[model samples]
Target: GYILSYNGGNIVNAKTGEKLFAQFLPDEVIPILYRYAKEKNHALLGYAGNEIITEMPDDQYVKEESRINKMNIRKVENLFEALEPHPTKLLMTGDPADMLKAENELSEILGDRMDIFRSAPFFLELVPKGIDKAKSLLRLLSKINLTPADMIAFGDGYNDLSMLKLAGMGVAMQNAAPEVRAEADYITLSNEEDGIAAALEHFCKRIFKSKRLKFRMWFKYGLKAQKLLAQGI
Candidate 1:
């Protein structure tokens, strides 16, 4: 098993702690992000390797986020200096209104060097271009001798859009964003109602009843299924 963290900026072996892949922000972009955060008074969090670095340690929003995510908060006086040359991802959180503004401005400021998007209403994420869940999953699948067609993906967030589309079976929860549901192959119950379990059961039953012997055989052997629950953090 493997874990794709920071929206696939980093992939690691779930059992052995071995790094399968990692993509960090370019050295040039770190200063840009830091300058933007400082000038805008936005709370910024940097994911550098395994550490979470931030400048606003006492900011209420940052404190709440750390508590909720159980993140070890490393408060730095200067994030750009702390992270320097190798930060994997950056997350900016604040009022949704401010986030929207930041998203728009950063999109133009960073241009094509990075991908900037709102993972949540109040949270904006920045990662290197070409790094996303689907792309990293493809890399992992190739190493394991499997294809996207062999996988089942589930998601509900905007960031999950690509992964949902790339999988052979894309299941969206009832509570998913409208865009997500529209792109899914099937819609299941909401997460609170055990949506993932419901979708798996329905597919398993259908596979058993249908004439698709290939899928049945694969299931009987060992289905190479991939499940992604986007936290939208």
Candidate 2:
């Protein structure tokens, strides 16, 4: 299973892609967003974060969406109705002022009931309050009776900080921002250099005290340096 929206949303069964739970834009916050969209000011733009709606191409899509708003800011005549029943999450624009606008206007409206934060550089997410990746991972661990010590989390972004901190072994990518790197237990190679594979190799070597296990498997597959080993004699 994997956490989305920094753990506010989740895919419970990874292989089959099952959704166990989700959070949405609260009712009180919607109207404020509606006013913001309708006013067409402060660049506070957004879209109805449902999957099907989001997949619709810009041209084929009926609603007028914004190119400036990186979220695609789907324009809807009836904002509430357009959001519909399955609008699990809301992806807001990344503009600093746009983010600030929501905070200033809906901070009190949302209060403790909602979560509004900048989990990434490109988008601001809205999820249920107290919902985060670490919390969900903990719940999943509880069911399996596995503690954080059994987990090895990998991350490369701001949203990953929580999980990285909570994991038994958190490995951050070389490309990760400085803050994310700080939260990691160890910094690995960059994503482009196969950081995950590299980290796993190191972890496994530490476990077995040698790379022999991997070499044995390689030998069985007829992909080994057998000549070099034999030359040692």
Candidate 3:
């Protein structure tokens, strides 16, 4: 269920295998949280901030994604096909919060794609006011020629709330914050039980090969190496 990236292994301490700087969240907020959590000796250390933006991007209203032409940005919708809803239903109903909930539900039935971006609570707090995963994803969508109705995201923490709500099929893990769960359209398996893999298999319609497939492929070669070592050939 863990999502490993190339940078993950780069930060580990050589001799001790201890992580030197391994938590999520933006660079600015991390030091403050670290200092506070260090003094308190808290196991779950992070920045619980005053302002957290949990809203989706205002892509529909804005035409241009970014003023900086140098950056290559695309809306999440455009990067991958099979992400947007059919017929592209644009419904208008109520207040700010209610409208978002309606949008989340609408996306689930209409769109058929979901992608997971797992991050810690601190990362969510790092989002500047008025900026969110939806906005970032929208940037991706704009670049790729897709809409917000095409993508889905799964999460279980505060950071995941905006992303989940904005995603076409925002799913909350069973072990998510109450606030976060409230924003989700569906609830899936717990993080500890290969939940991400299960969700991807079922919803994404992906064909998964067993982990043992690699072992089976290489076992004969490994045995040959062992035999050669024994013969000193």
Can you give the lDDT of residue 8 in candidate 3?
26
- Candidate 3, residues 1-233, lDDT tens digits: the string is 12211112113444575543232323343344334323432221111111111112233211111221122223332211212222111112223353344335433532233111223321111222233455555555665577767876887766567678777889888888788888988788887777777787777543335546667767978899889999998
Q: TM-scores across all candidates? A: 0.77, 0.65, 0.37
Candidate number with greatest lDDT: 1
Per-residue lDDT of candidate 2, residues 79-154 (tens digit): 4566666344554543556666666565566757777665545445566677777887887787668999999999
lDDT of 3: 0.43
Q: Of the candidates numbered 1 and 2, which has the greater TM-score value?
A: 1
**Backbone clash total, candidate 2:** 1
> Which parts of model 1 have CA positions greater than 4 angstroms off?
48-51, 57-74, 208-233
Q: TM-score of the candidate numbered 3?
A: 0.37
lDDT of 2 at 27: 68
Clashes by residue pair, model 1: none
Worst lDDT 10-window in candidate 2: 59-68
Best by TM-score: 1
- Position 3, candidate 2: lDDT: 42
Residue 230 in model 3: lDDT: 100
